[model samples]
Target: MRYDDDPWQVAIWTSTDGTAWELVPDLDSFGRAGLRDIASSDEGLMVAIGYEVLPPEEGSQDPFTQAGKIWRSENGIDWIAVEGIAGQFGDVAYRQGEWVVVGAIDGRAVIHTSADLVNWSTAMLDGLESALGESKAPCPLTGRQRRNGRSLAGWPISAPPSSAPQLAWRSASGAGMHWVGQVDWAE
Candidate 1:
């Protein structure tokens, strides 16, 4: 869960039974950030993704400057913050032995993949530019798992002239994803 204050704090809690919970501490060293999503593998690896808030620039009107942040844990108690990958990460999911994080970089949609959470590769979703139109910024991405061993990523795209956003989706089993079309939620 996340704290309601600035320098947005995040905490992880564990419970052997649903009745009692304990908080994991010392995560403050990860810096000023807010977590967006968390995922765990069957092998007991946990990954959390979010954006790090950078100090505001002098005389700047917008104070929220952000960089992507990732943290990994093996035992759910000890977490190590990862650095270097760039983007505003929105969501993460573990599928087929790989960890996939979805977000936007420079206003463009991007997907990051890693097998060990140490080595990562990035792919830009150029197709989204054509689908979302020229003037629109990249929408936040969310990942969901299906019972059939497939994963899905989706985002809302505005039509034009400020119309209601439509939800577009893509399906993936491993590394490749194919467009699954969009749904008009306004109807």
Candidate 2:
């Protein structure tokens, strides 16, 4: 199991008999902007996300307004840092052949695509919103969304990391929608 409580903290749990449980923390540690979503990739490795954060204290200033960070682990229990990624507090989903992460920037969602889960490509998210046309996708460390919505405002609330078709994330909504998204490897 994973940490569904806080986006910044990651934990691995194991139960051989189905009644006992133990938590494991990985070593692939890195600074987090907000620490949002986590997913297992096709390579059988665990991936953790990081992005822009509100800073430790509200009154304090964050040198970097928002940045992205990525962490990976070979086993579910131990983690390692992936070099060079930016963004904070958003959503992470494994899709097609890459990781689709979404985060907010200046009150709007910024989207980016990554293939190796280490380096990232610029995402303006023009297909989704205009404000993001020329803006870079904000890195999200932790994001959450419901499962459904009846109106446009509810878009992010209904789409989250899904656990169907083996293991993959289907939601493509921009950062604006990442509210409470969590990793669902098993549905």
Candidate 3:
């Protein structure tokens, strides 16, 4: 799994037997970099996506939100930055010979696709709303399933009413959307 250390540096830990883990060293490049999601391409290129929230300047109302970034690694050890793409991007995945990322732009759900992980095109999910009128895809998306030659998609329920979180899953293979299980905090 990939996460940010206490110093806000990206950290990657690997476990083969699901019991013992080994920390990979020197993967941190940016001091204030915090990772949100990561994906590996079919060609062995691994990408980590997240945003760097700058500290609020003097007299500034809010300066927490900053532009997003992408870091690519061929062997998951040494990483290289891919410039020219920036925003509050959440998650990324390599599917169907392309790299697709989903996040919010100006409080709207946006999807970006790239063939070479450099140049990209974006689309806004304007009408993809659930019965509760929660259409925003602000959470990090994950899950890759290729059954009958189609991509499967899934993401968590953003801004749930209760304190506990839930997930909404779907399939590009045309199985429609469904809700997974939920947990109670006071159990």
- Candidate 3 lDDT by residue in tens digits, 27-84: 7564467787889877888988886646666576763545677888888888788876
Better of 2 and 3 by TM-score: 3
Q: For candidate 1, what is the total of clashing residue pairs?
A: 0
Per-prediction count of colliding residue pairs?
0, 34, 1
For each candidate, the alpha-carbon lDDT, in order, equals 0.69, 0.48, 0.62
Q: Any runs in candidate 2 off by more than 4 Å, and if so which?
A: 1-10, 14-20, 25-34, 51-68, 126-187
Q: Model 2 — which ten-residue stretch has the worst lDDT?
A: 149-158
Model 3 pairs whose backbones collide? 68-87
The Cα RMSD in angstroms, rounded to one decimal, for candidate 1 relative to the true structure is 5.2
lDDT of 3: 0.62
Assess every candidate by TM-score: 0.75, 0.49, 0.67
**Which portions of model 3 miss their true places by more than 4 Å?**
1-6, 61-63, 128-148, 154-187
Q: Quick one: best lDDT, which candidate?
A: 1
The whole-model C-alpha lDDT of candidate 1 against the native structure comes to 0.69
TM-score of 1: 0.75
Q: What shift in Å separates residue 167 of candidate 2 from its native position after superposition?
A: 21
Question: Judged by TM-score, which candidate is best?
Answer: 1
lDDT tens string, model 2, 15-70? Answer: 78989998765533543334556777787777767643334445544433445566
- Candidate 1 lDDT over residue span 1-187, tens digit each: 2232464667777779988998887777556777778899988888888877776666666656667889888876566887657788878888768888888888778778888877888877777767766655433555554535446666756535575433333345454755555434332
